[model samples]
Target chain A: MPKFLIWIAALAALIALPHGLSFSQQEILVFLTINVLLVASYRLLTLTGEWSLGHVVIMGVGAYSSALLTKKLGVYVPVSMLLGGVIAALIAVLLSFPLFRMKGFYFLIGSFAAGEIIRLLWKRFRDPFGGAKGIKGIDPMPDFSVGFYQFDFFEPTSYYYFAGVVVAVCLWILWRIEKSPVGLTFHAVHWQDKLAQASGVNVRAYRTLAFAIASGFAGISGALLAHYVGTINPNAFDIDLMVFVLTWAIVGGTATFYGPILGCVVLTVINEVVLRELGLEQMRPLIYGAIMILSILFLPNGLESIVQKLTKRRAAGGAPERSPAE
Target chain B: MLDLLAQTGLNAVYAASYISLVAVGLVLIFGVMGVINFAHGELFMAGAYAIVALYAGLNVPFFLAVAAGLLFVGCLGLLMEKALFRPLKDNPLGGLVASIGFLMILQALAVMGFGVRMVHIPPVTQEVIAFSEKVRLPVARLYVIIAAIVLLSALWYFLKRTKFGWALRASAQDPEAAALQGISITQTARIAMFIGAGLAGIAGALTAPLVSVNPHMGHSVIVTAFIVIIVGGVGSLEGAIVASVAYALVHTFVTTFWDGVLADIVGLSLMLLVLIVKPTGLFGSADRA
Candidate 1:
């Protein structure tokens, strides 16, 4: 099958997905859709050779910003969500000044400290942030109808469809950005900043750009989550969620764009569907931990490496294979 | 106001003691192995739970339980070295991920074995030392402070005077050079892991009666430790200790005057400031990070 046909088929499957699932699963699907965007955005940041522990908190910045906009300022829900992304991007630009000074482990810890400060701010200020309990009863996406279908917002399927379209478009933009010259600069920056700089690449500017754009998408994802979940809290964007994102990126392998998405989807299925159905709620973390360790130990290159290997083997007997841009 | 300040100062000292213990261990592990043990906090929790099992559940003597906590958690560190860190030695990122996995496993084990509820251990002593009418220090807090000083001083002596200590420091400073000098990297790694994990364990064991013990308790512990280590400068033991004291004083005073959340913000902001101004930390050199 050609690439376009494969994409169309995947889109059709995604469109048809929630209809076959139970109500709770439909809700999970909506979340999964949002997380795909979240992880994909995180990949963009990693493209510039930096892993931010603050990414989830930046997502929270979006959720909190959008939630506050809608709840306090009475802005339109959709407009607030977009503004939320913009605000998150703005915050990333500001944070980049202090954060981009450090590299490697220092950057990791620096980002984490930056994120904690934000979360602590949320907990300290109850006036607008609603204190530790966070903003509750966030406005949902207003119900609307297209010619062929109605979106009730109350129904998970409807929310899934709404979120799915937004995520698909966001993913497309992210894909385009990754394939552009800027993306190549990001890769160059990742591999060797000095070389990229010598070759006339503005390393810092590209790093900041990737950070801002990734943060923007993450914010949008957070906004989608806030509306669907009907609430937002400091705890919601805590380090645990960050760890999950990190796990997704690592387990799926960050070598390719689809890697983290594949990891997120697969892990979500196992965690939500398999573990939940097995009634092993208590043991979920235990099993997940084991899986993480096993994968790192045995499949250090990630699940994507396996996929890459299989694809390479298949393509070996065919025409010469082109290396992935990644 | 003076009395309150004094009391808060005493509290800060107590806080600094445990924080430094944890931070030092973390720094030690990172220095030698070149991987941050995300599970360090969980190791502390394990130490607390060891007390819960031995002292609270089985009626062991408090001091003996504390000792057992140290040894048991130290052995757990050896297990980590043999199983996780040693195998993934070449891959620091992999080691980090593995430590995270170990952290989750330890937390889950705690939840399963002891339930998610907080466990309370009986106080070994109810005595409070009164500096003044309002300025008082609990005897238990003094125990932590004393242990921190004695252990740190002894560690200093060992590092300066002992061959193994020299070996450990040598490996931490430059692993290949240390190995070329006939020091076994594996042995030094084991020693560092043992001491590092032991320090955190002992901190948890000493403070078990003072703080609420639970599976998720490690979360905040880890956060505070991270802030301390970052502010102290990564891979610098002296820096970790000094930063822990500085952070504790600032945090304790902030929490006293303002609130707990603000204290956390202040601590984190202090770290960010250090990163921005001196990315190597207050006492750190540029090469370590």
Candidate 2:
């Protein structure tokens, strides 16, 4: 019952959170929400024990697909977003054919090479991709009314609420997937591929499944950003951003589901609010790099490990009286 | 048309020289240490910046600046090994992530120190070796080519002929057995990191006058090096050289006839093909990586 109340309270806080922020902070909140999904999806891929440098490009695939589908084919904004995710998943599946042939460091390099080729293709083909400038004037989600609230697409607060709900649903689905047997198979493949294969688990298929699903969610995040920003270029999803995502995952520690999310939120707050206020924006990358290294060296288990330790201590101390009787 | 082909060939040779230099260093580091040094391209950039500061800013002689660049970047490598790689020796991925952090630090420092614009160094020389009206190679490019040949030959002789070379090779092949045989992993690692980083630094310094010198210039160089090392086979110095030459030929011709983007596309696609056909690379055995 207490856990249920905590969930309700958390939901209430999320719903009320954006109202207190300034205009730019609300905007940052919306991006932070989308990035939460991006990093979470990235964690799903990492569960299979292969870290890819191409994930942001896969996200770009989603953004591009969503943008093009709405502009050229006249698809509805919401529908195009779903299609964007589906296309990104399909592309991941296709890439897996060549990419899955290698493992470890080779996989990392191959994926990077594959992503660069995709980006270059977008650069070379100006017809639909808009060359280097990328697709602009992207269609925004049409404003609509719900019974309790009106969603004005122009307002960051409204967009935040809408994206928040969408992201919550996506996170629920990801959580459920992680808890399922499929997720267990992903763990198995990661830890002991040979053993998993020997147990008739088809390791390659699970790896492909994880990659596809992760790309699908990443695509959705990209679509959300595309509709909100109304513009994107190949540079928007370059290696610099990819490194940021990688750092989030690493610094957050990928052992638990919420680690990367925590890493993303904390880093975003540090990057956006704290740094911006202090007027150290130019030193953001340098400071960020230092943070990444320090975290890796000192907190190898991530911020969640601290959370875990605290929770364990609370459980031990608080439950000591009833433990023997129980 | 024949003259154009010859000119393209010369360009390919120059490209091959610098690229092989970078790729070989990458290979050497990967071989000796079981970690991929993602900061390698940044190390190359540091070398170029050394020349930028010393040769261009302080008016040092070009050759003296090149030597300084090599030694300085080599020292940077040693710092990485001691500070980052050594502690995370057991976890290759952690080492890689740390190197990436190092890469960002280097890039940020470059940006802060030099600002974002491309830095122009006065050309080392105005002379060009003319084979024909269309076929010519600049003196600066000649210096890079000569340096690559001499340094690589020296590296080859050192690796094949010296006691330290055997120790490095043995450790690369089997760290556990090498340790059992009384080889100092730390010492070998230090040597490998220094030479590997120095090689990349020298390549960057030599080619600084010929190419655009910017903080982010390392990106394309690293990409080219990755393609070459993968095509040649990871951990194989000989394979890196062979693959570099082949890649440069194909890329140079494609850029000459078509466009630079297409040339990149081709180079990447060729790497993918090699990866698909032979993941161990053309010359590498399956056990190394």
Candidate 3:
């Protein structure tokens, strides 16, 4: 019952959180909400023990598809977002045919190559992808109203609330997937693919499944960003952005479901709030790099390990219970 | 048409020289340390910056600036070994992550020290060698080619003939057995890191005059090196050189005939094809992958 109340309180805080921030911080909050989805989806792919360098490109796939569908095909903004995710997933499946042939290091490089090819295609073709400048004047999510409150697409707070709900539902689905039997198979395949294969689990199929699902969610996050930002370019989803995602996942420690999300939130706080306040915008990458190195060296288990210790200490005097949500 | 082809061939040879230098460094570091040095491109960038500061800014002698670039970037490699790679020795991924962090730091340093714009370095020479009426190779490019041949041959000699070279190769083959045989992994790692980084540094320094020197310039160098190393086989030095030549020939010819973007696509597609057809690379043994 107490845990349930805690969940309610957390939800309430998230819902009300953007109201207090300045216009810019509220904008950051919206981006933070979308990034939580991006990093969380990234964690899903990592569950199968393969790190992909092309995840941001897959996200770009979503952004491009969503923007194009609405502009060219006259699809509704919301429906186009879903279709964008589906297309991203389909692309992942196709990439897996060439990518899954190798494992470990080879997989990393191959995925990068595949992603670069996709980006190059986007750059080479000016017709659909708008060449290097990418698509501009993207359709925004149409505002709607309920009895209690009206959503204004122009306001960051409204977008924040809408994105928050969508991301929350997505996170719930991801959490459920991680807890299911398929999730266990992902873990099995990661730890020992041959053993998993011997036990009747199709290793490659599970890997592809994880990759597809992860790409699907990443695509959704990209769509959310596109509608909000109203513009994107090929450079928007370059390796630099991918590096941020990679650092978030690694620095957050991928042992637990919430690790990467926690990493994303904390790092975003540091990068956006603290550094911006300090007027250290130019030194942001330097400081962030230092933080990544320090965390890996000293806090290899990540911030979650710290959270676990605090929770464990509090629970020492009481009966042990598994947390309902990971 | 024949003149254009001849000129393109000369351009490919010059491209091959610098690319092999960078790719061989990457291969050497991966061979000895079992970690992909993501900061390698930044090290190459640092080398260019060294020449920028010394030769361009301070008006230092050109060859002296090149040597200083090699030593400076090589020392940076040692620093990475001591501060980052050494502690994270057991975890290859951790080392890679740390190298990425280091890469960011290097790039930030470059940006802070020299703003984001392209740095214009004065020409080292004005002489161009004329093979024919239509074919020409600049003296600066000749410097790069000569340096590549000499440095690579020296490296080959050190690896095949020297005691330290033998120790390095043995450890690369099997760290456990090498350790059992009383080989010092730390010593070999340092030496390999130095030589590998020095090679990349020199490549950058030698080419700094030929290309636009900028902080982000390493991006393309690293990408080309990756394609070359992967196509040549991950752990093979000779394969890296051969692959570098082949890739340069294809890329240069394509760029000459078609657009640069299509050339990039073709090069990347060739890499993908090799990856799909033979995951171990063209010359790599199966065990390495």
Candidate 4:
């Protein structure tokens, strides 16, 4: 009953949180909400024990598909976003044939190569992709009203609330998937592919499934960003952004479901709120870089381990710690 | 048409020279330490910055600046070994992340030291060795080609003939066994890092005056190097060189005939093809992958 109350309080805080912030903070909140989904989806892919460098590109696939569908085909924004994820998943499925042939370091490099090819294609084809400048003047989410509150898409707070709900639902689905039998198979594939294969677990199929599902969620995150930001270029989804996602995953630690989410939130708070307030805009990357190195060197297991330790201590004291799913 | 083709061919050779320098160093480091140095491109950028400071800013002799670039960047590599790679030796992924952090730090340092704009270094020489109306090779480019050949030959000799070279190769093959045989892994790692980083540094220094120098200039160079090393087969020095030449030829021709963006696409696609057909790379043994 206490756990349920905590969940209600947290959701209430999230709902009311953006209201207390300035306009810019609200904007950052919207992005943070989207990024939580992005990083969470990244953790899903990592669960299969293959770290791909092409994830951002797959996200781009979602953005581009959604944006094009709305602009050219006159599809509704929400439906287009869903189709965007489907397309991204389909692309991941196609890419897996070429990419999954290798493992470990080879997979990393190969995925990068595949992603670069996709970005170049976007750059080369000016007709649909708008060349290097990318698609601009994207359709925004249309405003709607419930009995209690009216959603004004133009306001950052409205978008934040919208994105938060989407992310919360997405996180719920992801948590469900992770706890399912399929998720167990993914873990099996990650730990020992040979043993899993011997035990009738189709290692390749599970890997593909994880990749597809992860890409689907990543696509949704991209779609959310596209509608909110109203612009995205080939350069927007480049390796620099990919590096940030990687840093979040590593710093947050991927052992638990909430690890990357914790990483994304904390780092975003540090980078956006703290750094901006301090006016260290130019030195941001340097400071961020130093933080990354220090964390990897000292906190190699990531911030999640710290959480785990605290939880374990609490459990030992007879008061059970909160479940990560909550 | 033939003259144009000849000009592009010469251009390709020059491109091949500097690319092989960077790719070979990356391969050497990966071979010995088993860690991909993501900061390698930043090291190349540092080499260029060395020239920008010494040769261009201080008006020192160009050759001296080039030499300083090599030494300075080589020392940077040693620092990386001591500070980052050494402690994280058992964790390849951790080492990779650390290198990325290091890469960001270098890039930020460059940005702070030399703003985000491109730095214009005065040309070392304007003399063009013209073979025909269309075919021409600048003396500056000749310097890069000659230096690549000389330095690579010296590296080959060092690896093939020297006792330290034997130790480096032995450690690269199997660190535990090599250590058991009394070859110090630390000593070999330092030497490999130095030579590998020095090669990249020299390549950057040689090409600095020819290309626009900037903090982010390493981005494309590292990408090209990655493609070359992957195509050549990881851990194979000879394969890196060969793949560099082949990649340069294809990329230069595509750029000449089509466009730069198309050329990049062709290069990446070629890499993907190589990866799909042979995950271990074109010249790599099956066990390496």
Best by DockQ: 1
Instruction: Give the per-residue lDDT of model 4 (tens digit) for A1-326.
Output: 98899999998998889879999998999999999999999999998899899999999999999999999999999999999999999999999999999888889999999998999899999999999999999999999999899999999998988888889899999999988999878877887789999999888889999999999999999999999999989998999889889999989988888999999999999999999999998888898889999998998888997988888786665433323210
DockQ of each candidate, alpha-carbon based: 0.68, 0.47, 0.59, 0.60
Docking class of 2: acceptable
DockQ of 1: 0.68
Instruction: List, residue by residue over A215-286, the lDDT tens digit for candidate 1.
Output: 999999999999999989999999999999999998998888899999999999998999999999999999
| Better DockQ candidate (1, 2) | 1
**How close is chain B to the truth by TM-score, in each candidate?**
0.98, 0.99, 0.98, 0.99
- What's every prediction's RMSD, in angstroms? 1.9, 3.6, 2.4, 2.4
- Pairs of colliding residues, candidate 2: none
For each of the candidates, give the backbone clash count: 0, 0, 0, 0
For candidate 2, the lDDT comes to: 0.91
CAPRI-style docking class of model 4 based on DockQ: medium
Tens-digit per-residue lDDT, B1-289, candidate 4: 9999999999999999999999999999999999999999999999999999999999999999999999999999999999999998877888888999999999999999999999999999999999999899999999999999999999999999999899989999889999999999999999999999999999999999999999999999999999999999999999999999999999999999999999999999989889889867788765343
- By how many angstroms RMSD does model 3 differ from the true structure? 2.4
Chain A TM-score per candidate? Answer: 0.96, 0.96, 0.96, 0.96
Q: How high a TM-score does candidate 1 get?
A: 0.97
For candidate 1, the iRMS in Å is 2.0
True contacts kept of 2: 0.50
Q: Give the TM-score of candidate 3.
A: 0.97
Which digits, one per residue and each the tens of the lDDT, describe model 2 over residues B1-289?
Answer: 9999898999999999999999999999999898888899999999999999999999999999999999999999999999999998876768877988899889989999998899999999999989888899998999999999999999999999999999999999999999999999999999999999999999999988878899898888888999998999998999999999999999999999999989999999999899989988988886576
TM-score of each: 0.97, 0.96, 0.97, 0.98
- Runs off by more than 4 Å, candidate 3: A316-326, B287-289
